[model samples]
Target chain A: MKNFYKVGLMLTVSALLAGCGNLTNSSLSSHSNGTKTSKVTTTGTSKSGQYSTLLQGGEYHTSAITGLNSESDSDNASNPKSFEAGLLEISKKEFSPDKYFFQEGKMISASQAQKWLGRKSKNNPEGLNPEDNGSTDADKRNPIYLQQLLEQDFYTQNDKNYDLSGMTIGLSMNDVDYYTKEKYGAKFETKISDEQRLSEGREMANEIVNRLRRRSNLKNITITVGLYKQNVNDSLVGGTFFNYGVSSPGQKKVTNWKNISQQNQVLPVVNDEKPINSNDSEDFSNFKNHIQSYFSNLSGVTAQTHYQDGKLKGMAINITTQFYGVAQIDSFTQFVQDAAGKYLPQQPTIEIKIQTVQDPEAILVKDYNTKQYSSHVFASY
Target chain B: MKNFYKVGLMLTVSALLAGCGNLTNSSLSSHSNGTKTSKVTTTGTSKSGQYSTLLQGGEYHTSAITGLNSESDSDNASNPKSFEAGLLEISKKEFSPDKYFFQEGKMISASQAQKWLGRKSKNNPEGLNPEDNGSTDADKRNPIYLQQLLEQDFYTQNDKNYDLSGMTIGLSMNDVDYYTKEKYGAKFETKISDEQRLSEGREMANEIVNRLRRRSNLKNITITVGLYKQNVNDSLVGGTFFNYGVSSPGQKKVTNWKNISQQNQVLPVVNDEKPINSNDSEDFSNFKNHIQSYFSNLSGVTAQTHYQDGKLKGMAINITTQFYGVAQIDSFTQFVQDAAGKYLPQQPTIEIKIQTVQDPEAILVKDYNTKQYSSHVFASY
Candidate 1:
């Protein structure tokens, strides 16, 4: 019989699961005028259990349930994960898994979604994007504010059938509207100012909410909206959600909005004199140095950190190593795991991807508040 | 505001959903001893709602639930998806979606799994791999049979709790055992004959079933097993499951075996004198030519088709083109959708991916028994 590769899986498992809780408050903080404003929401953890059956039975659908293929349209690879994951995280605040089960959005048909994503016109009053200014010059721009619209429906178990009780909409606004003078022509970008982008996004949200409310079925359902700003096409990291608002049943508009200061910043800031979060940048630099110090053959170590308000929320680190052996990767993963524990903030979730020039060699993950990290090495035969 | 992109989504939606049913009989055919043998079993389609609440609530875990991270270890990119998806398909026959809810396997701990994936020895009898026969010659080799083990648990709602009702195990057996003599040494592969591989796989399955039965908690639970042969290291396509069996409650071993003749063959078969199914090969070739003829600048067109017994089961087509505009991609997708309808087999599921030099431009999917295909063109602007 084949012999097993001895690794401390049990030790890692117990450590990985330590400090676990069912539904825990995940707080996001932001500093405004030097005064910190934090939003506390209970996000369901892995231990809390993910989905519930539609009392009648079938699979729970997420947007693009087959895969997150809808978001795949973006050139930025990380945008899909950030958009989908961020929306789910935001949804948990309004629709708790304890009470509501998840389902693919049935309210917005694909055609309707397409219409809403297009430029405004008399024929298509439902459009949520700005009408084209008919400008060819990249500098004098008619920026398309909205890129994609994502819908998620939440259902509550009612006796025998699950009824739609709530809904969440994610509007992916473009930071830079991209276009070309003609088909296959040189691409051009119309850079949008943050002030204009946010204001335009809020207006679109209001219009969308009002239009959606017109439907008899959705008129009395609680609707939650998350306004997301997609990263520029060339950015390595993904975009962030800046604002969110919830309209109560029967409400026509989102009167009150909550400011969300979430950001995805590349670690080891290239040219910026002052990093957004000095402590996180410093911690990441130390972590990188510590791992690279141990293994001089390491090619490079880079990270994308997610921050809420000013606090580090998550870190995705990529470690490129020259070593290719399974045993060597396993040992290196352990070393990196230890270094991460010592140098990185304990409150944020962390993931390390060990890659060669061709493919991934191993991966290590640590959830927020967890004491231990779990690592897996691919068996390359 | 922007107007929607109209692409007949409603017609496609209705057409795409034709002949849909929940937990329907999915038959698998295999010709044995010149006699056609077919096994009829129920499988959960998208309509058969997937998960159930674990009374207490949380996410239903799958093996490598975070993502199929465990399978990502394989050098063959498609192996992970084939192994995970194929096993789930086989499991659906025994575990109906309406009755059983899915969860990650808890019975086999990660550490136990590592032990079982190892070579059998006096100190570690739990090992499931063959013992090392020290030999420098590749001709005289001790081949490793088991590459990986995957577990899936099915739960039935009982009163207020969901209890494990059945379990399925997927054994990823190697067709070619890959190894290196020393750390970072040049890689070597020992090809195992089909007859030897299948027999050894059966014996290993028996041992695993017996060992699992020894656990009191698992003693009475029904267990199903599927034996998969992993494709060689550099394969473009993944592996296939050849045999499967089920052990009833209180049964110690799988006494009756069923044959599965599923395969993943690259279209325009590279070197075989005759393709596995002549009709499928012809259909794929025609489809490729039809699409390319419409768009002359198309760089390349390739496909991966899956077959059950001798009939085509599914097709994944990749179409590479130089076109970059959203409108052009969208129109081209429509043309491909039409060509696929006219040229491909109607019974099998079909997916066509349209890609540019930089990234994926569009995607078209037509599930089995669906008349109209659903298409999405990425908004690249």
Candidate 2:
């Protein structure tokens, strides 16, 4: 019995290790146009039968003021007439690049990045300098920084026309490679497929566009949904993680923006032996369920449109219902089916980005050794 | 302008009822105990003080038992022993009665009283003798059957070692007059104060002795505390109230022993309007304090003891200290000069009594008109 128990334990551990290995090699990619296409197979049972009839064929329109502009101009353009007839018509059906990547002048400060990553450097290391100058290097590719930059750009560019009232949205699980390196002092191999990345990105972009179309200015708004994938190496640690795109309303001028400044960046220690695949599927499922539940429970969400760049993606048939003394969306499952039934045969995709991070101080060194850090990081931006 | 308006209104009223007088009187007595007691005193700068030290005496030993008969015949009779010792030595020290009246087992059914108070020649006009017939009168007095008898006996008993264990107590403001009228009718007014003619015989004897000694087992024990003054018809109604005494462990036998029939007697309800000129300096001080604040914050308490022959009386101090924290009392203004400064003046006290209730149904009639109820009634007793 003892030997059998030991063998069973061993098998479980081996399975977990295999899952982690798969995650390391996984490759996911997103198109520059915001479309996500993937070829990975899902392990879970499909509920595609529910998506029999989906909405399709919608045109996307762009606002006259799509680049970086002051709040006053954005407000003027967002007036009822422009918002309903012009700005809304354009931004409503399409996903804009300026809405997902950082604009030139809106990058976070080095101190802010350090606080998020839980580390400190000597000086601001911006541009090509990589001698721990306390600023981020423009050439360096930091996936975590890129994720934050995307979030900021998305909010600034789409906020005026989207009417994304009363929602909490943000990018999460960014800079996994950097965090892993700093905390674990060990490198991880990516296993996500490129096909999966593209699909996930498209799905996310479509969801965001749909959400923007149903906008109302009566509540707080948040919209976060996308995926990306990349590799981590010493040379890419100091480079800019997020590339600035077209600026939009409530944004600073591109001329006054710093060049890929490492203003806000922090290196957190990563745990070397901490297994990440123990419950990956379960974790993802839970995350998806949480998002669906949140949307389903919201009040006054009448309609939604999905898109990728300038292309119209899908639309959701929002049904309001009262339950437990509050107004709520009946079900996101129903919405997804009504919005993207034809798109279900293809596997929805998500991208995973990885990067190496160097920590000058041993601030989180003890935490890494103790295996106290959680694998999935949740970023507000 | 005011004269013209008044003249117009007057002419209208005169046209409606020219012959009706404005003055009128209702049949109801506004001086009922409940109504008069609810009135708030508007006097300014009334001298306020609390009851003095609660002497440890009377039935203290019997009450130490947590449950009914739990400590029966136990070798560790520490409680009973301490109570006896305290009562014996109370006179040497400066100690105040826990309250003024002893209400133990004064409850008696009208049927039970028929043999003692009802004359053989007396005939019920409606041929409904409550004693012989199964009537609601017996049921009405069910809750008070034991308390009234005890109070009457406790006041009349003179024995210092009166063993009043195994008796219950109750209280009622209307019992005395009810029983008196039922027995004597019109002659009640003339024979009420006569020691021989009064229903409480030996009990009154014992109580009178205790009152003379200024140490009553009746202290701090009453289910209800009421204030009354003689009206034009020489009937009881609400007025300046004072605290009543209750039976305690040391004075139980003396107050409620059934073998001593005279032990069931009640003290007269003293009216505050009547002048009190006691030779003792403390009497005047007590009267002043009692009139101002004693009744304002009276506490409620319940005590259990052995009842014998349906009579019980005793006193127990219910001390509850309010402190901002565990270390300090909230309102300790002056330290007691005596007893190594261990005591404080103006401490809260609650007098409870178990007296024979005349209208048992009346006990259920709470003064719902006021948000606060009389705190003097011993709820659980």
Model 2 C-alpha lDDT per residue in residues A212-259, reported as the tens digit of each score: 333332112233232222222321111111111221222221112111
Q: When only chain A is evaluated, what TM-score does every model earn?
A: 0.80, 0.19
Which window of ten consecutive residues has the lowest lDDT sum in model 2 chain A?
A359-368
lDDT of 2 by residue, B237-287 (tens): 111111122234444223432221111111122444332212212322332
Which candidate ranks first by DockQ, i.e. highest? 1
TM-score of 1: 0.47
DockQ, each predicted model:
0.01, 0.01
lDDT of 1: 0.64
Candidates in order: C-alpha RMSD to true structure? 24.0, 34.8
